[model samples]
Target: MSVGDETLRNVNLVTMTDPLLGQVVEQYRVESLIGSGAMGMVYRGVHQVIGKAVAIKVLKLDYADDPEMVQRLVREARTVNAIRHPAIVDIFGFGTLPRSEQPYIVMDLLEGDPLDSYLKDHAPMKPRDVIPMLDELLSALSAAHAVGVIHRDLKPGNVFVESKPDGQKGIKVIDFGLAKQADRAGGSVKPTNPGTLLGTPAFMAPEQVLGTKVTPSTDLYAVGGIAYQMLTNHLPHEAPSAIEVLSQKMQHDPIRPRQWQPSLDEDLDGWVMNLLSREPEKRMKDADEARRALRRIGDGKTTGAQPVSGARPAVRTATGVVPRRDWGEARTLITEESSGVHDKPADVSTDRHVSPWAATNTEHPAQVEVEEATMPPQPAPRQKFQSARIEAPTVAANPDEVLAEVKKKESQRSLAPVALPVDAPGEVPVTVPPSRAGLYLALGAAVLALLAGLAWLLSQK
Candidate 1:
C-alpha cells in the first residue's frame, strides 16, 4: 500500500478490545497487570493450553497505530523467539489480536525487586557477596551474545534475582525490549530527535552514550558499572544531568573500585577498571571469560582468598570518620529500618580480612553508620569531569541515521507503511518441541553418509 493510504487507514483506526484483560490468544488468560512502560503494559497471564504462567507484553495502542512501531514490535518478537537459553528470558510465542496492528510477546514471569532498589536497601555488600551476582549476570550475557542478541542496556534495574525451589539462587535478565539482532547493521530503536540519548545514561557504556555503533563488548562495560557499584555502595561517580554522566563515561577515568571500598582486592579493582575501560576493544571481549573469573571468586578458588598459615588478621581504621574503603558500609547495616526512617546499625563489625585483591589501610575498615538524622536536606552537586570531542559520524552508522529519520516522522501521529516483502508474505512460524531435534537430525545424517559410502564401495568391488 502507498504511504498516504496507510497513513489514512491508521489515522482513522477504531479502538478495539482491551488486551490487558483476558485476550485469549493461544489459550493464555491475560490476568492482572505486572508492569507498564512507554510502549505498553505487561500482564501476569497463564496459558490454559499448557497450564503455564507467563508475562504478556502488549504493544500500546498509541504505538500500535503507527506502522513503524508495529514493525518494530514485531521485529523484537521475532528476534527474541529466535534465541533459546535458560539464562536469557524465555519467549513462548507472539500473537496479534483480530483487529490490532501490533503483536504481543508471551514470556516467563520472573519474581524479584529491581536490582537497584535491592542494592539501595542493602549496600556495601561484602566483595565475596557480589561474586555470585556477577557470575549470574555474566552467564546471562554470555548466553545472549552467543545467540547474537546484544542487550544494549544492562543496568541494576534490569537484573532479577529469582528464588529457586531448591533454595539455590537463580537469575533472569529482562528488557530485551531493546535487544538488537547481532547481524543487523543498524538499530531497531531510533530517537525522533538528534543528540538525544536512547539508553539509560547512568549505566550506558561510553560507546553507547556516544550513539555510535556498538558490539558485545559494549554490554560488558555496563556490566562493569554494576560490579563497580557492588564493590562500593556509592557509584564510582554520579552526575546531576544524564548528558554529563554520558560525558564522563565517554571520557574520564573512573576512580578504581577499591579506592571507594578499601577492603576490595587489588586484582578485583584491576578487573573492574578493565571492564569499565572507555574503549570497548580494551575491555574483556567475552563475558564468559569474565564469568569464569567470577566463578573463581564465588567458589573460593581465587588465589587471593587462600588462608594464610602463620600471619594473623590485621586491624585497620580502629577510630576515624569512616575510611574511603568503607564509604557505604554505614548505609547497608540498617536491616530493620523503613526506606526513609532509620539510623545506621551500631552493631556492625568488619572481618578484618585482606587478600590479593583486597584493599589494605593502616587501620581496620570502619564500622560506623552516618545516621539518617545527620544527612543534609539536599544532596550535594556531583563533580563534573571535562568531556571529550565528539568523533566524526562513522559510515557504520548511516543506516541508523535512516532509522532516526523514520522515528522523526513517527511523532506526527501518522502511521506510514514501509515497503513490505511481496513474494513470501506474512509471518512464517517455527517451533522447537521439547524433544531433541538437533540430535535426531545429526543421527539421520550420519546414517545416510554410512549407507552411501557402503554402496559406493560395493559397486567398485
Candidate 2:
C-alpha cells in the first residue's frame, strides 16, 4: 500500500480487551500504561515465569474485534520477528491478553528516546558518527524490504536507538503496525481510507505524497528527508495539507545541501542531496546506498565532490527550491537572529536538526466547517497527526466504519463509569436469585410449629 502521511487529529483511540492474560497471566504482571495507539495501550509488564521485565501491547475491544487490522498487525509483527538485526526491535511473542479476548504482542522492553527527539537534541554530528547509525538503519530497512515488507512510513520518531551489548549504540526500527507488503498497492484491501493520505508529509516521498505506487524507493525518499534534516536541520518544502505537501514532493526539487553548507565535504553533501532527488532512480536506491555514500564521505576519499568554504549566498535553484522558510520555524529563527545572540549554525557532531521552513496551507472552507455543525464536536488531528513519520497504519479503513467507531468510542467515553476489573471468569456470570414468597411461607410454618410445641409443653406442666 502506498503510504500517505496522516496527521491524527482529535480522535479517541480505544483498545481491545485482555482475554489471554485473563485476570491473571503466567508471570507477566501488567504495569501502568506506557503509551497508546489507535489499536491499544502499551504497558510495562513483568514476566513472572522468567523473572524478567517485558512489555505487553494489549488490544482494546475497539480494535480487538477488528480482525483484519489485528491480523495485519500480527502478520507484520511475525514478519518483524523473523528478522533479527541489531537495528530492528525484537518481537518476543504475540498472544491473547489475560481476561479479555483481545490479542497482544510481547516485545523486548527498550530504553531510549524516539529518533525525532533524539535528532532534535543532537545538534550536528560529524559524518563519522552519523554514518554508523544510518548504516544500521539502512541495513535494517534492506532486511525488511528484502522480505517483501515496505515500511510505508519511516521517520525519526519510528526509529529507536539503544546502547547495544557491543558497547555501541544500536538503532532498532519499530512500529510496523502500518507496514505493507510490496504486492498490496492499489488493491481492494488498501491500508488507508479513500483519499486519506498516509505517511508523514514532511519526510514522505513525492510519489508517496501523491498516493502513487511505492516501493523500497519510497522509504529511500524519507531517508533522504532525514539526511536533509541531518545536514541542514530543515525539511525540503512545507505545505498546508497532506495532499498539497505531496504535490510539492511531486513537483518541487529540494535545496541541495551544498547550498546550505558550502564548506560541507562534497561526498557527504552529495550523499545528502542524492537522497532528495525527485527521481527514485536518481536518488540513492535504499538505506545501504545512502549509508555507503555517507561512509565514503566520512573516510575523506572524496567519491563525489571536495569540500568548499564560506557562505556562497543561498542561491535560488531553478529546481523549485523555495527561499521562504516555514512560518513556524521562521518565527523561531527570526527571533534567534534578532536577539543579538547570532548563534553559529550547528556543527556536524550530533546530527544537529534544523526543521525546514514550511509554508502553512489554509484549510478548505468545507473542511474548516464540517465539524462545526456536527451534533457534538470533538478534537480532530491538527498538523501533527498529518505527519506520518512512523510506520502507522496509513491504510484507510472504511470511512463509515472509522467514523462510526470514532463516534461510538466517544459516546462510550461519556457514558462509562469508573472501571474495575471483573478479575475472574466467574465474577460476571455468578449471581444469587431473589427470595420468593413461598420461602417466606415455609419459614412462617416452621415458626408456628415451634410455638405450638411450646404451648403443648406448657399445658402438660
Candidate 3:
C-alpha cells in the first residue's frame, strides 16, 4: 500500500479508540472533542497547572505524516500570535500528541457558536445588529492586515460570535489555517502554486478564484459576501458546485442587496456592493476603510446615490430585479415607449428587454401592478412651434442698439427651433433648430430624410 493509504488505515484504527480523552497533551488535558472535520479535530482542554480552559486543534493522522500540512498548522499559530488583536482568538502554545506525533494548536476557548450558525438562526439581521458585528470583525482584520497577516480563508464559519459581559455581541475571527504572511513587497511570503485556488468559493474574491495574487482587499471582499448573506440570508452566488459558484462570481456581480430587500438602507447596500466588487482596486482599500465606511453608512453621513463603477446594473424583469448586462439598450427602449414617437407601441410583451429601472415585472403579477401603479405618467408633448412675436422698439431707442438686440434675440430663437425635453430629470433640453423658424423646419425635415436613407442603406447591407 502507498504511504497515504497506510496512513488512512492507521487513522481508521485510531478512531476505534479514544486514546486522547483525559490525557495530557503538552500542558493541557484533552477533555472532549468539540468538533471534527476533514483536516483535524478540536478538543476542549484545560491547562494542567492553571486549570484555564482552552481549545486544542489536532491534525488528522492521515496528515500528521505530511510535512506541508504540519507546517500549515504551525504557520496558523504563528500568524495569530503575530496579530495580537483581542477580537482574534489567541494561540498560546503549539505541540504534538505523544502517541501519534500529530501536530496540535492550543488556542482560546470561545464560548459561542460560529457566525454561520448564528446567521442561520437569525439571518436577515437588522443593520443595527450587523453593523456592530462587522465593526468588530473589521477591527480584528485591520490589526491582522497591519501585521502583514492575511486571513485568506475568511468566511462565516471562521467567525465566532459570543455575547459580551456588556450586553453587546463580540466577534472573534478564527481559523487562520490558510493565512499567509505577506512580505514588504505585497506578495505572499509563501506563495501557493500557480492555479491553486485557496479560500472558500462562496466568499472568495475574484482574484482568489482566478488563482492570482491576493492582497488585504481579498479578505474585505469576503467580508462583503458575509455582509450580503447577513442582510439577505442568501449567498451572493449560489450554485450546485464550488466550480460553478466560482465561475458565476467571475462572470457576474451579485444582485444588489436592495433588490433582495428594498427596505434596506441605500448606503448599506452601496457599501456592501463596494466591498463585493470583483476588482480589488474597486473594493475598500483595507479593513480600516471598510470599517469607516460602515460607520458612515450606519450614521447616514454619506449618500450612496452614485452607482458603483464597473458594477453590473440590476435588470428590471417582470418578476423582480436581477443583475444583468445590456442595461443601456433596455433603457433606450423605455424612452422610446414613453415618447409616443412610434405609430404603434413597440410590442414589449414579446420583447424581454425593458428599462433597468422600469417596473415591468412580467413574472410576478402583484409586483407588476404595484410598479405600474406607481409609475409616473408620461408628460404631454410640448408644442414644437412657439410663435416668436416681436414688438417694434420705441422710437427714442438707438437704432444701432435696437438692431443689435434684435439680432441677438433672433440668433437665440433660431438656435432652438425644436428643443426637446430629455428623458432624464435635471438634464438641459436639447435644441435642433436654426436661425429662422421656417428654415429650421426645413432643415429638420431634410435631416430626418437623410437619417432614414442612411438607416435603410445599413439595413440592406
Candidate 4:
C-alpha cells in the first residue's frame, strides 16, 4: 500500500477498534483519544504501575517518512524537559507504539482549561488577576531563558491554568514545538521551512513578523501581547488575516492598553509598554528586570506615576533622579521629566537605533501631535535672547542704526503702562534702556553744559 493509504488505514483502525485503548507503551496503558493535530494524536492514558493519569502524544504514521517532523516532536519533548519549572508542563515518558510504529510522548494530563478557552467563557480578567499569572509566566520564561531556550510560541492557547489539589491555581506553559536554541538560526525544523514566519500574528513581535532572529526578549513581547489581551479582552494587534495583522503592527503600534481599557491605570500601563517595546534592546533587559517591575506594581511602589508618553519609567537612582531607561543598557539622565502617556516618537532620538519597519513609513499623525504636545515652552528671556542674537549681525554692520533699533524696541516695550514703574501722580515716568548709547549721549550733553557754566563763573571772578 502507498504511504497515504497506509496512514488512512491506521487512522481507520485506531478509530474503529480503539486498538491502543488497552495497549501498553512502557508502563502507561492508552485509554482514549484526547485530541489530534496535523503532526500528532494525543491520548488519555494511565500508568499501569503507578496508576496515575498521563497524556500520550503520538506522532502520526502519515509523516513517518518526514524525518524533520519526527525530529521536531522529539525536540519539543527534550527542550521542555530541559527547563524544569512548575509553570511549564511536565514530560513523563517517550516511546513508540509497537502495533503502528507511531512515536509517542507522555506528559502531565492537564485537567484545566487553556487560558484562551477560560477567557472566552469568563469575563475579562482584571489586571490584578492577570498579574500573578504573568509573574508565574515570567518565572517559567526566566528559567527557560537562563538555559538559552526561547519559547517562540507563547499565546493564551499555549498556557494552561488548573486548580491544584491544594485548591490554589497553577499554571503550565505548553508546546515548545517552535522553540529554537538561542545560538542557532535558520536551520531548525520549522512548521514552515527554515527562515519562514513562525508564531501567531496577533502576538508576534515586529522582528518575528519580519522573520528576524528571536531572543529571550522576543518571548516577552508575546507576554506583553498576552497581558494586553488578559486586561482588555482583546489582542494588542488583531485582524482577520495574519498578513493584515503583520502589516498593521509594521504600520502602527498597538494602542496603549490604558487607552483601550481606562482602568489599567498609569504605572501598570507603563509596565506593559516596557514589555511591548518594538526594539528588543528597549524592552526589559532580561526576564528578571521584568519580574522586579511587576513586583513593584504588586507592592504598590510604582503608583500614581504615569510613565512619560512613549517612554519607559525612569529608574530612580540613589539621589532620587529618574534617568531615562529607553536607550537600552545605557543610562541617559533626564531629570524631573513629567510622566504621562504620549504618542511614541516616529523615530526615537537617533537614527541608528530606529525600527527598520518605521524607517520606511512617514511619521504617524499621532506621533506628530505627541512631539508638539511634549515640546517645552521656550522661556521669555530665552526668546528675547534669541531675538537679539538674530539681529546681532545687523547691529555689527551699523552701530548707529543698531542703537536706534534697540531704542525703538525699548520705546515699544515701555509704551505698555504695565511695564512702566509708578511715579509721583502727575509726573510721567520716562523709560530708559539700561546701558543704552542714548543714555550715554544725554549724560555727555549735561556734562558739557556744566563745564560751560563753570568757565563763565571763572571769567566773572
Candidate 5:
C-alpha cells in the first residue's frame, strides 16, 4: 500500500494507539513522538529522499473537527513566516493528514531545552547571562511588534534556549498559537472574542487578565515576568492558586527584583520593575524601545540617571527643592532637569535618601519622581569655590523645627571664616576679607527671614 493509504488506514485506530508514528505525511516520515500539548502532538520527521530532519507539529484528534482550533494552528505557521526573525522559530511547511484531516506544521528542529527546563536545571542565572538572553528575546519581540503581531502568550516555556556551535547562548521564541495581529496590520485573522483569558496566569499583564485590549506592551509585561524568573528563579506573582495569582497581578506590582535578589544591579532592577508596571501605557512603549533600554542597562548606562533634554522639568517648590509628586498609580516617573546644574533633591521625610535614579510607587514620602535620561547633558566645568554642603537631620521634624535648624546652620556657616584658594603655586591661603564677611552675614539673615516667613505661611495653610 502507498504511504498515503497507510496514513488513511490508521484513521480509525484507538486513542491509545500512536497513529501518526511511523506514518508518512507529505514528503517526510514520522520517526517518533517528540512531545505533546493540549492542542497538538509534535513528531520528529525526516525528509524521504534528502534525509533532512524536521519537527512536525500535528493537531490532536480531539480538535481536528474544530475549525477555530484548526485555523489557530494555521495562523501560528503564518505568523512565524511573517516575522522572519532569527530569534523566532522558522516554519517550513503546513499540511493536513490524508483521512484524519488533522493539520500539522513542519519547522526547524531546534536542539535545546525550553527556557523553563533550562531554568530548572540552572536558574538564578547571573545578570551577565540573563541580559543577553533578554536582549535577543526582546529583539525577536521587536520584530513581531513591527509586523503588528503580538505574542499574547509569551512565557518561559515558549522561549527555547539553543546552544550555538561557538559556545554562545541563543534563543528562539516559539508557539504563536495565541498571537493576534493588530487591527491596523490588515491581517485577516479575526480579533479574539472579549472575556477570553488566553495567557499563562503568572505572566499575564493586568489588561490581559481583565480580558481587555492587548497591545505590544502586553507582551512586554510577560517579558518582565520571564526576566524576573531568569534572574531570581521565581515568578513575579506567586499564589496558592492561579486565580489568586491573576488577582495579585491585577491589584499589585511585583516586588522589585532587588528585593528578591539584593545583589542584582540597580539598573537591572529598575528595568525589570518598569516592565512589570501594572498599566500597559506605563511599561516600555514598544519592544524596540525595551530592547534599547536593555542594551543601555547592559552597557552600564543606568536609566533615569540623566534627564531628557526636552522633557518638562519637575515642579520646583518655594524652598528651591523639587517636591515629590504623588505617583498614585504604579508608574515610573521620568523627570528632567530644567537648569544646567544637576541638583539632587532630598526627600522631605528625614530618615532616608531617595536615589534620583530609581523610584517606585510607595506609601512613604521617600518615593520621589525619577526621569529616564535619554539624552545626557554636557558636563559642566567644575567651580573653583563650592559652598559647604548641609546634610538633612536624621530625625523627623515639623516644618517650624526644620526651619529653625536651617537658620542655626546658616548662622554658624556665616560666622565661620571662609578659606580662599591660592591661584599661584606655593601661595598661602587667604580668609574672606572683612567686607565679604559682612556681606555674607547680611545674606544669611535675609535667607533665614525668607525661610521663616515661608514656614509660617505653610503652617497657616
Candidate 6:
C-alpha cells in the first residue's frame, strides 16, 4: 500500500482489530494481538527457525508516511539493542511487512502482566518486596544512560513483571517507543511537534512537559514517579486530562509517599521526592546513584511489622535532603521510627535474597541472607583485590659476563664441599668412594685398647 493509503487506514485503527494477526511476518507467525496503543499493536508470535515465542510490535499505519515516525520506530530497536541489559526487553529483529508499509519489531515474548496490572493485585508492595523490581528498573535506566538513551516514558504499564518457566518473577522494561537520544544534536530526529507531550503525563518530568532537552536525569525522574506509585498505590500526580496533569507536574510539588503510606520511611519518601523535583538539576545525577540509594533502603533491616490500628510513625523534619551522596547520612534520622515497617522478620531468620542475575536463571539464586538486624546497618563487606603478575622485559647479555657469572657459581660450589646437587631425572648418580664408617669404628677400638693398657699400668703402680 502507498504511504497515504496506509496513513488513512491507521487513522481509524483505534477500534479495529489488527489486519496482520494470524499471518506470517518475516520469520514470525503472528498468533494473536497481545495489546494495542496509539503507536501500534503487539502480537504474540512464534519464530519459525528457533521455535521460540516472541512479541511482535508493528508500527501504526498512520505513522508509515512520516519520516520522523519511521526513524523513531527504528531508533527504538537500535536504542534497546545498544542498551543490552537483561532488565530491558530483548529485541530480536526489525523489519517492514512484506507487502504492507507497516514496520515491525520482534522482541522477547513476556509471560506475565505489566507492573500496572501486577499492582492491581499487589499494590503498595513492601519496600523489601519491591526492592528487586526497583533495582532492575534503575539498572535498565543506568544501562540506557550509559549508552545515551533516555526512556522518556517509564510508567508501570511499560514495565513487565514476568513469571518465567521456572517459578520466579522477573522485571523487564518494555516499549522504548518514546525513548530520546540523550546526546543527539544536529543528527537527531524530532518526532513530535514542539510543546507537544510525548510520554505518559502522569510520569513525565517537568522539563519533558515543557519541551526541554532531556538527559539521564529525565529517566531518573520517571523512576521516582514509578517508585512513588509502587509504594503509595497511586501516581505522584493524576488528573482527568493530559493538560491538567502536565500543568500540575510543572507547577505543583508532589505529595510525599508517606502521606499515603505513613508506615514508610521518611528517608525513602525524601529520595522519591528528590526524583520528582520540578527542576532537572535537583534530581539524582543518574540512574546508577538512584539504584544505589534504593539498594541502601532495601538493605536496611526492618521488623516487617504492619502498622497497628490507628497508629502512625512519628514524622520529623526531613534533613540532609536529597542529592547527598551518602545515603546513610540522610537515612540516620529516621532509623528508629522506620525500623518496624521493614519487610523482614523482627528476629534473626533466613530470608530469600535474589541477586540481580536471578531473573535470567531462576534455578540458582545468587544470594540468600540469614542474619539478625539487632544492630545498625554494618559497612558493606570489603572486596578482595587480586594481584596480577608482571614480567620484566628480556635483553641479550655479553658472552664475557655470562662466562664470569658461570665461574663465580663454580667457585661458590667448590667452597661449599658438602653441597651436593641432586641429579636431574633420567641422569646417572655421581659415584663417591666409601663413607668413613669402617675408619671411625677402627679408631674407636684403638682408643679402647689404649684405655685398657693405661688402666693396667695404674693397677701395677
Best by TM-score: 3
lDDT (Cα) of model 5: 0.64
RMSD of 4: 20.4
C-alpha lDDT of all candidate models, in order? 0.56, 0.55, 0.65, 0.60, 0.64, 0.60
Estimate the TM-score for candidate 3: 0.65
The true-versus-predicted C-alpha distance at residue 184 of model 5, in Å, is 3.3
Put down candidate 5 lDDT per residue, 1-461, tens digits, no spaces. 00100011123323347877778977899987666655677777899999998888888899998998888888888999998999998887898899898888888887777787688778889999999999999999888888889987788778888888898889989888778888553222333765355667777777765556778888898899999889877677654445545544554455555544656776677678778877676677787888887888788765345323322222222111122344311122112221324222212221233222234322223223444232112222111111101111011123233234445544554465545668899999787633566789999999999999999999999
- Please provide TM-scores, in order, for all candidate models, with all chains considered together: 0.59, 0.61, 0.65, 0.63, 0.64, 0.59
Alpha carbon lDDT at 44, candidate 3: 79
Kindly provide the TM-score of model 2 when superposed on the true structure, using C-alpha atoms. Answer: 0.61
Better of 2 and 4 by TM-score: 4
Steric clash pairs (candidate 4): 309-342
lDDT of 6 at 170: 77
Assess candidate 5 and give its TM-score to the true structure: 0.64
lDDT of 1 by residue, 122-216 (tens): 67678776787788788777767777778776776667656667876556676665667665432223332345445566667766655667777
lDDT (C-alpha) at residue 260 in model 5: 49
The residue-by-residue lDDT of candidate 3 on 120-227, one tens digit each, is: 679889999999999999999898888888888787777888777787788888877778888752344433755356557678777775566788888898899889
RMSD of each: 27.3, 26.7, 21.5, 20.4, 19.6, 27.2
lDDT (Cα, tens digit) per residue for candidate 2, span 80-149? 8756666776777778754567787777777666666566667355556667777778888878776667
Worst 10 residues of 2 by lDDT: 355-364
**Backbone N/Cα/C clashes per model:** 10, 62, 5, 1, 3, 0
Kindly give the stretch of ten consecutive residues in candidate 4 with the minimal lDDT sum. 1-10
- C-alpha lDDT (0 to 100) for residue 127 of candidate 2: 58
Off by over 4 Å in 3: 1-16, 185-191, 303-313, 316-461
